[model samples]
Target chain A: MAKKFLQRLGLKDKLLAIIVPLLVLAAWQGAVSQKLCSELILTPPLTLLNTLLELAQSGDLTLNILASLKRVMIGFLLGGTSGFVIGILMALSPFLNRIFGPLIKALQQVPEFAWMPLIIMFLGIDEFAKYFFVAIGAFYPMVLNTYQGVSGVPEKYHELARVFDYKSFRYLFKVIIPSALPSIITGIRLSLGLSWMFVVGAELFGSDSGVGYLMTWGRAVFQIDLVMAGLILVGVIGFAMNFLLERAEKQFLLWREPVDGRPA
Target chain B: MSNNKGTLEIRNLSKSFIVDNSPLQILNNINLTVTSGSFVSIVGSSGCGKTTLLRIILGLENHYDGEALMDGKQIVGPGTNRGIVFQDHRLLPWLTVGENVAFGLDKLNRKEKKLLVDEHLQLVGLIGFESVYPSQLSGGMAQRVAIARALANKPEMLLLDEPLGALDALTRMYMQKELERLWQLEKITMIMVTHDIEEAIYLSDKVVIMSSRPGIIKQIIDVSSSRPRDRASSEFMQIKAEILEEFHLGTEYTFAYAI
Candidate 1:
């Protein structure tokens, strides 16, 4: 009876997910309003919402968020395409892998920020440096995932390819790529996430625009509220993008999943 | 050197593998000939290299000691003349059933490819299941799709590596009959490797039994019993006992072991 009642309750995942965040917000508000914590440290949720409104009224939030998003998109595409092509080439030919694999592996081991000094030194604190840094950040995950996906195609499928006498290009497109698509999509998701992170890091080095610059400017002005607002925006937008992409990925690879019964 | 388009000749084929740094022979100088449009089944226990022999004929294993000739040409690597149905369905999971069937027909025009795909799906009794993924299909249905994929290629010989070995008893029996009907309908050369001796006897023109551990053909028994032959008949039991004697599983041998 209890189980049936629980089933009938029909608590949707979204409803359940919102509960914890709401509780945290309520707790933070209680701490601030009760004067149990420093006001500057634990800004109330309402205060953050008001700060968002003020920033929107000033048009700063919109501009800075747009700037960061633009960098993330451009960098993701640049990194994703090159990584995909190079990954396929390396996976297909051992000679190419032998020549370039070691150097790429070594380069990837170096952190994304480690290249910033040299990048900024050559290109200066401009959009170019930010793009380059974010692109490099996105590159490693995409390349590694794509390489794994292509190379790890099952031997059974390869036998089918051989049995059918497929040519090299046809095999690559029809079998290898389709087989590796799930992994490639995983790589893309991870790369987009990393690029988002790197864009902010790049902007923080020195920039006049972007949410990273807003946070830095807020710090310069000693206004902790602005910094909090910037942090909240970054977290929410990043999370929302990731959540949407995951849904899209699932929809795109529907054929990869098994359906229950034959459709009427 | 004879130009028998559908005939296959295996000349003293031998294969060995380096297992744990020691050379272990798998196939021991195997020789067989399959005439055009005939069904030949190879039956043996596991580790007997029965599958290995099928692989050799399928042009999968290249390092074997001898030659496999299909028609007048040497069977070197995988070619268009032979279609293989692996033990597993091995269908591309990302593709729909129709796409999997038409995978090899990329060179053909769209209309021709669609027609062929439809015809083969119909042949395998899966006409309405064209849009579903392989994962959605049951084991038997997926196996049928695999067979359809192979048949769509129009190969001279169909190589089966225990295709129905994974099915339940009822499905296995049904598929055995379906396979026989398919063979009769297609009238193409078929070489199947199976563990079910009854399956071998019911479908093939001849049943070739192999002994395990460096596998060799111990005997080739021609099952000239009529189409859809009775499984419970005394003649069938006699042949079954004869095969059991070769495997040392006959009643007399069992009684001897018990004593």
Candidate 2:
């Protein structure tokens, strides 16, 4: 009886999630009508919606979205690939840890924004610079997470592998990689989110394309609607990407019981 | 080498680990001998280093003194000749039961390996669940898969460290019977470490009881009862009582003895 009650409670909880967003939108519209803030500081919902439609009709919006997506794809590919390789290497070798571990740790301490001015100087604000920044942003977390995952394989598992005479690359691919997969996938998801965030930051620094650049253009021309539209689009896309990755993570790691099912 | 496959003799075995800036003695001067196709059980309290001794024998713990001789040859590292079943079924979570069982038999052709895995799964009474992964298995079922995996190697000796320790009472009882049958069928030299006195007595031809903290063999009881020992019989109860007395259980001195 209690199980059924809890299940119904969970269903009601999900309904509240749906209701809460609608409530927030209603509150925003109410605040706009009440004129709680100057239009410059907080653009009303209808104005932002109208701006989004106008931009879509102009075709520049899609182009900007495409450009940003392209940068994210390229950067994520490069960064994620290298991070995975290096992470595995570091996990496998204590010697590599001694040499590169400290260096990577130091690099991680600097914010993505801190790299902006230096990267802009080196690559001259080109597409390469944007892609490079996005890639670098993705790399550290991916590498670090993979290293932790691979190295964190319980000693017992390794011993089992050894007892089975699994001391080769085949063993690594079959046992170690599968064992480390949850962590690796977590790293990839994190890297994916940062790829988008860093690409936006790259665009913020005077790129000629992307939603970020378009937002910049809007702000310069005093088109508050366009800026709001751009922010909303960035948010939706970021949320969508994260949502998709989360689903992928669930599918990939189906072996692990969903967190809710298992006891803490 | 070809004829004398299952003989194992350990000489002056010792192991220690550094703990809090001091060398903690785990195993001290352990030695044993097992002829071909014999069953031995090592029973001790938790943290008595029984598992450590098993690890040393399996070559999983190499930072130990003394040599393990198989047919008078020095055992250096884990070899196919010694199969080990861990307490937790270390079956790869991602691999299906068949694949996990087939894991160590990578040298065999795909067909042969499949056949062998299927055979062993049947031997362990997990025949139809070959396609299932570890996550789908109950604790006892997973442990059975671990046993099947170990048996797939067709090793001369099987080293099981509390292989059924995770199972509930009923399952453990059933598994003990199954293990004994499997042992009779395979004729592999079996060495198991368990704390359950009944289990040790029920399954083993000989039981080596060890003392706690800086572990050492306290007593070696020879279970002289013949095949299919009667657990409910007076003989079995008498043996159980004797073993319990040796461990100082049901005695006024139990606490002091344990210390």
Candidate No. with top TM-score: 1
Strongest candidate by lDDT = 1
Off by over 4 Å in 1: A1-14, A35-42, A94-105, A257-264, B1-4, B20-22, B252-259
Instruction: For residues A122-184, write the lDDT of model 2, one tens digit per residue.
Output: 898889988899999899889999999999988877877788777779778978888999999
Each candidate's DockQ: 0.40, 0.43
lDDT of 2 at A17: 70
Residue range B44-67, candidate 1, lDDT tens digits: 889999999988888888888887
lDDT of 2 at B76: 75
Worst 10 residues of 1 chain A by lDDT: A255-264
Worst 10 residues of 2 chain B by lDDT: B250-259
Q: For model 2, how does the per-residue alpha-carbon lDDT over B1-259 read when each residue is reduced to its tens digit?
A: 2335778888888789999999999888888887888899999899889998888778777788887887688777898989988888888877888999999998899999989998999988898998876878888888888889988988988999999998899999999998999899998889999999989989988898888778887888899898798777767777777789877775655334443
- Native-to-model Cα distance after best TM-score fit, residue A83 in candidate 1, in Å: 2.8
